[model samples]
Target chain A: MIKQLFRSCIFLLVLNAALSSCSNNGVVKESSTADKMGRFPEKGDMIMLTDRPPQLETPLNIFQQDITPNDYFFVRWHLSQILTKIDIDTFRLYIGGAVDKPIAISMKDLKSKYPADSVIALAICSGNSRSTFSPRVPSGQWGNGAMGNAKWKGVKLKTILEAAGIKKGAIEVTFQGMDKGPLPDIPVFVKSLSIDHALDGEVLIAYEMNGQDIPMLNGYPLKLVVPGWYATYWVGSLNTIKVLTDTFKGFWMTKAYQVVNNAEANESPDSPAKVTVPVSHIKLNSIFILPEPHQPVAYGQPCHVEGLAFNDGTGIKKVEVSVDSGKNWMETTLNPEISKYSWRRWKYEWVPKTIGINHLMVRATDNNGFTQTSKQWNRGGYAKGFIEQLDVKVK
Target chain B: MLKKTQFIFIATLCCLFLVLHSCTQQKQPDIAKPADENPNTFTVKGSVREIFINHDEPDFPEAEGKEIFTSTCTMCHTLRYISIQPNFPHKTWEAEVNKMITKFHAPIDSVRAGKIVNYLVTIKGVKQ
Candidate 1:
């Protein structure tokens, strides 16, 4: 009986050792703290994000302010070698060609001669909603943060040209920024403006933004702030100001930013024509910021949904939110109107009554009765306006 | 019978001690050598040493550049705005840099401009 008990005890000890080893092998390593806190994509990941086509992914929050901060501003560089620093002195802005007397003015002279003006304007990429297109276009898949509002202070373009003395035969005035990149034909960064539009009082040569000097990213020292126009025309590090004799044919002005309409309508290779014009006026559009995409919420809990809305020329009249897939809509409360050009913030409280998938859609109506709708397909992928939608799952 | 049981117990304890002692004495297999020897060394030539060293210091001079960037650039804008652009070549960069001084009036001269460019080139410039 004693011998049998000893053998049984040995067998039990071996079995316990084997079980412990198996458990050790099956152990799952605890996730690191860094994994828990999702940091910005490391250097290797930026390329992946840039190359991958834009999807319905939420933008990574980089700033503490309700408004997206400037550093964390989404980058959209068409060409390479964007500028960093500039010397303000000895820098000359030439206003010639269509002007009676071509005037070259120094920075000091510009400040002293012209009256400084400030206006808060929203600078948005013309292709802000490009990714929503059916066939994804090839460009920076910018999220909503591609736009921002700042108080721009500068001399109005009309004031600058009036002093220069405009001449006839000057149908357009060309504005060239110091930003230079190599093109297939011309190795320079330049754009032109129509004479009538160039002389508009709203067009300005901005030196200050948000009560401070403009940052390098936003065109430090000086940048052109064409109120209500897309940022593509707001040339940065402006170096040349020429009064054009005729229509400007710069690469960006003519070839690149143009929208080619009727591509399928006309099957010919050259059937489509260049849009070649700066996007004017903000379209009525809204975005959903809170309860990010695919975020889960407790059943029957009130979720606050918020977003921003703005228009280029007209003021935003109302922003409406729909939870039942646009069948019914409710007007959201608008934050205090900051500036005519800056986007107005809006929010709505939503309580999910049922435990299921809910589709949320937001649409904005401008003062002029223009509402956001699906964009017509074009080659240049300009002015895409699909209704922004979000899907949320509730437990 | 008791004497025989005590002897058996002593023998069993001795056997267990010998087995444990032998197991402890057995040498663990030497750790497998790393697959590749030169792990950190770059395959290409021409000093990666400079890049490592250059990146070590905060590209912007902590005191001077910050002061100049804030006082001048921030007068009209924020420093966060300027740092966004990737670096550029000297020529194209010169034009934009001059715009601030000539068009915007940043109070920078040729000497100061050179310093600012040097600082910016280190931080923002893309490697050719």
Candidate 2:
């Protein structure tokens, strides 16, 4: 009996040490934490960049479908103290500041009192592909998964503000959410838009996403969906709307998320641009979906190459693919547009002739005749609108 | 009597195996279940259930001032923020640490802040 007990103790210790080493060895990869897959509540396994102010990126394969599911939607929040629990019954969206008759509307009131509006729009992070930028910037080093397309259901911002009776001198509209900073001096996360953009019927205060209540992590009760703009403006767990007569200069707007005042928002590292403006409007970009990086393709087999092309609500005129290192270009068939603001899917049938590695590139042209440029760089790594290239090996 | 002792020993070994497996699986930080729910699982509330993210800190390389770096930086965010960043110049790391102190009001003293910057520069700094 004594001999048996000693043997069992030795066996258990060995097992424990082996398992601990396995987990420790897994962290040997560069950026192991970023590469580590995590499953948050109500979310699928995603690339977790941080956990405190949860920043989760959707897997790239989820974008193959036209509509990104709410469970796999990308999440990005700025403030550290996020809303974990809430009493939806007592929640009220307060509308005041530069209004003749300020009013507080409940969730029930928001749905019943105002007309319901729905739109299928794409909300992309301003720094979505910041990792891919050459001379990499030191922000959220995300790939092309920091964006998602969803069917947002809510009342129009115009309708909500008009119901509040906007004063005559209202110049800009500011939005605030329940999220707060850790320190009192740390500025509360807020964003502003011009009065004209706020009153635009397209801007929505979404309560439901993809046919259900927005996930708590994605912003439970309310989310401001600024269609055609970067997701930075789409505040989550939104509670307050203020109409300011003067220009609203907040830390988020005037200081952070500012890009160069140019078409591509490009700048040099040695000499940064002096003038900068708040980042808005998704830039023209396209990404290859099929034949994922390093995926093998059979020689002489007609592979169905697929991708997505999108701009700032401007309809895509065409998406061209180059299989021969941009020496030749072929136009791909664009699927029917879901909405003016939704991403347009494009497909191409290509037969690989070469047996070695073949470089594939994709670029999009919008209705305004603006074709994606081959090179772009910025200090903040915002607005990755350059041409995308993917390489695949043919067996 | 010998058979009974053997049976008890086997039972204890099985329980040890189970406990060891669970210990390896629990790499993520412990999070409490929602109110009035099972300890092991989350309550399914329609399609959009509440979510709790995993806060597993990465194993950073050991160096001088690593303790200060980990404690000061993680006061607001996970060390993954630093793990995900590509190698930057010393000036960039200095600016980043100073920004935390000045802009975001991180309560790191100047001397410790310099030490933290030195640690970051040692691990992930590149020449401009």
Candidate 3:
């Protein structure tokens, strides 16, 4: 709602200030979101960042279960024109180009052809915590709720590629969905993955999320699930799968959703790094489950300070919690996981002795040895896996 | 070493940052949050056929030049895009206005665009 209001604000000012700036068409070098209005509704406890094509985010506590509820799952669609209803009887999945033989398989044929395979994985937008960027980024000023973990049930993408018969020289596989933008000038939402990545067993064409036909906003008929990768690569409302012979250069892939092509995938807003790359596997991060910021904890009482930590499927090795503004640190206990790709739930016990504002923080290290940082800032507002700090008032 | 006024300015800025950038807004207890379903089999229920998102009207509905803004600028997108952001300064608003006109090819002519920018700077932008 606030975004629309900004859209209509007449051009009322002339460029007049001398502020530090980024090179993105002379936009000032701040990544902070200018959030005047609060959350808009996306459905079932989820808040929408944008309304037209419906981009939604889950609340922090929605992480109550490692497996997010299907009804509350967040939805994101780049295109404005989405097919609300599908004629399942006539729906066909067309697999064409760079294959031994082009094939169009119906929903029924897909179900009967391959046994359903399932995996629990997180689908995260690359800009999950974009709003928290200090200087403020221009769009999608979202908090961390832009991600969700779910048990997705579908056939492995490898199954379909195998049935199509591998033809040599195929380099990538492209996917298109049933949604489109308002104008033809706006590019179609198409994304392509490397052929090797496509054939990887981790990729799935999920028709069901958390034991139900995927919600309409969450992609009704199908979604391409790339475990550990950002949701941009996870094509929603999947329709066509086209194999390619060369590296894919689609706008969604080549242009948008890229991070600084560096080891840390981070760069400065004032001076951007050269050579950007598509934002790939998520970085390690943790969040507070209990004692939410400003939530009151009883003084001199036992309290469970808890939250979830996750990586791009690499297991969380250790989680450390600090209650006195990182003055004293304690190791948190992590619950045994049901799925490797899912987040690990962690908890720490705190007995607050004093009554005041108590800062609680949690940091995690993944098996990959990537430790969470105190602050993570990127130019396009992406991949912030900083240690989460919450201020709890112990009364 | 910063001057006293400079310290206050920076401190105010920091406080503002904390207020605007804090993760998770005030909790709403009444929102009905659903629980996770069994991660196994499935049965179809009701479906979402279509969505017509009802956006809120602009905050400055009664402000000057609101008519020109709604008539011209609401063509491509709703007003939510602008309203959702933090308070932008005059220059940022100018750049943003110019961006929409030059980059996005928004149909607002220079005169109207200038008026819109003026209104934004006067009402929504940082006070000089």
Q: In candidate 1, residue B93 scores what lDDT?
A: 53
Please provide TM-scores computed only on chain A for all of the candidate models, following their numbering.
0.78, 0.93, 0.87
Q: Write the per-residue lDDT of candidate 3 for residues B24-126, one digit (tens) a residue.
A: 2232122211223212122333432343344433345357777777666566565656655776677777877886666455667888987887777666677
DockQ of each: 0.02, 0.32, 0.06
Ranking by DockQ: 2, 3, 1
- C-alpha TM-scores of all predictions: 0.62, 0.88, 0.78
What clash count goes with each model? Answer: 26, 1, 39
lDDT of 1 by residue, A1-395 (tens): 56855775576557555654543442321122111111121111111122111111124343114444443334344333444434566567777777888888887887888898888887777777655554434444445655666678889989989898888787887777665443233335666778888877889998776666555545655688887777778887676788877778765665556654331211122254433344444556677777776788777888988877777768888889988888998999988887778778888999987688988898888887767763445544455455788888889
Instruction: Rank all candidate structures by their lDDT, best first, as comma-separated numbers.
Output: 2, 3, 1
lDDT-better candidate, 1 vs 2:
2
TM-score of chain B taken alone, every candidate: 0.42, 0.63, 0.54
**Which consecutive 10 residues in model 1 chain A have the weakest lDDT in total?**
A43-52
- Candidate 1: segments with Cα more than 4 A from true spot: A1-68, A183-187, A260-278, A374-376, B1-128
- lDDT (0-100) at residue B25 of candidate 2? 62
CAPRI-style grade of the A/B interface in model 2: acceptable
